[model samples]
Target: MSRADAYHKMLMSVSHFQHNIALILEAKALEASRSSQWLCHHLSAAQFGQNHGEQVKRSVEIHDHVLDVIDGLTKMEQALAKNMQALLGEPEAPDSGSLGDMLPLGGN
Candidate 1:
């Protein structure tokens, strides 16, 4: 390819990354909202059954928020993988980062 063609291709890659990132982010937000709503529904139902105490209510709130954040992060990661595939124009292996290496095996 000519220099101009190469430059155009580079620009296209960047554009694709930006567009896909936006789509994924929106998806993440939607997924998080759905999770929060579902949690709210179940918690409301549980509250109707009996008085579980303040502890239960507080725990439910904390769990709901944590789950929502985690689901959104998962969506973000999956979206990034899809974006990588698109940019490569082919199917590629997933990238897995393992933290085991960072931990000490044993204290001698």
Candidate 2:
């Protein structure tokens, strides 16, 4: 294949990669929000007590774990973007507010 054709294919692949990443991020955010809402509703239904406190603690731990998984996904996305940039002989784009920045957990 010609260089131009190869370059075009690479760009197409990168575009698809970006689109898929966006979808994954959106799905994860929705799941996290649903989980948080469900936890809040249940917690409110139950009367406050030692058991409630323990439940809240466990809920927080689970949320933290989910956030960590999200962070890992974000990192993988960034790495893929950088790899695509390199493959296309393009410079890294300057820092901008990414989807990760919009996360309530601050993408940490």
Candidate 3:
């Protein structure tokens, strides 16, 4: 494959990765919000210190950790997007072009 072909292929893969990460990040944000709401609702029913709250707090912490992971993934995807954009240049027609057109092996 030529340099352009290799560059395009890498760009396509990185773009796909970035898109997937974005979707995952959205889902994670929703999940974290729900978990936080649940934790707060459950904790508010109780008075002062109580063992029941510990489980809810732990659940919220777990969600927080997952959010942290998602945050890391988001950063990675951003870096990939920047590098891919620099490497591939801007889209000529605001379209990614079909795989059949972009592939080096004649879309095989």
Best by TM-score: 2
- TM-score for candidate 3, residues paired by index: 0.51
Rank the models by TM-score, top first: 2, 3, 1
Residues 15-96, candidate 2: write the lDDT tens digits: 8888998898899889879977986777553554547677678778887998898789868877986787688677743654
Estimate the TM-score for candidate 2: 0.65
Distance from true location, Cα of 75 in model 1, Å: 16
Residue runs of model 1 more than 4 Å from their true location after superposition: 44-108
Better candidate number, 1 or 3, judged by TM-score: 3
Best by lDDT: 2
Q: Residue 79 of candidate 2: its Cα lDDT?
A: 90
Which stretches of candidate 2 lie above 4 Å from their native place? 45-56, 91-108
Better of 1 and 2 by TM-score: 2
TM-score of each: 0.42, 0.65, 0.51
Give each prediction's root-mean-square deviation over alpha carbons. 8.9, 5.9, 11.1
Which 10-residue window of candidate 2 scores lowest in summed lDDT? 99-108
Residue 93 displacement (Å), model 3: 27
**All models: lDDT?**
0.69, 0.75, 0.69
| Clash totals in order | 0, 0, 0
* Candidate 2 RMSD to the correct structure: 5.9
Which candidate order results from sorting by lDDT in descending order? 2, 3, 1
lDDT by residue (tens digit), candidate 3, 5-89: 9987987787687788778779977987997798678756355356777767876877798788968876786567567657867
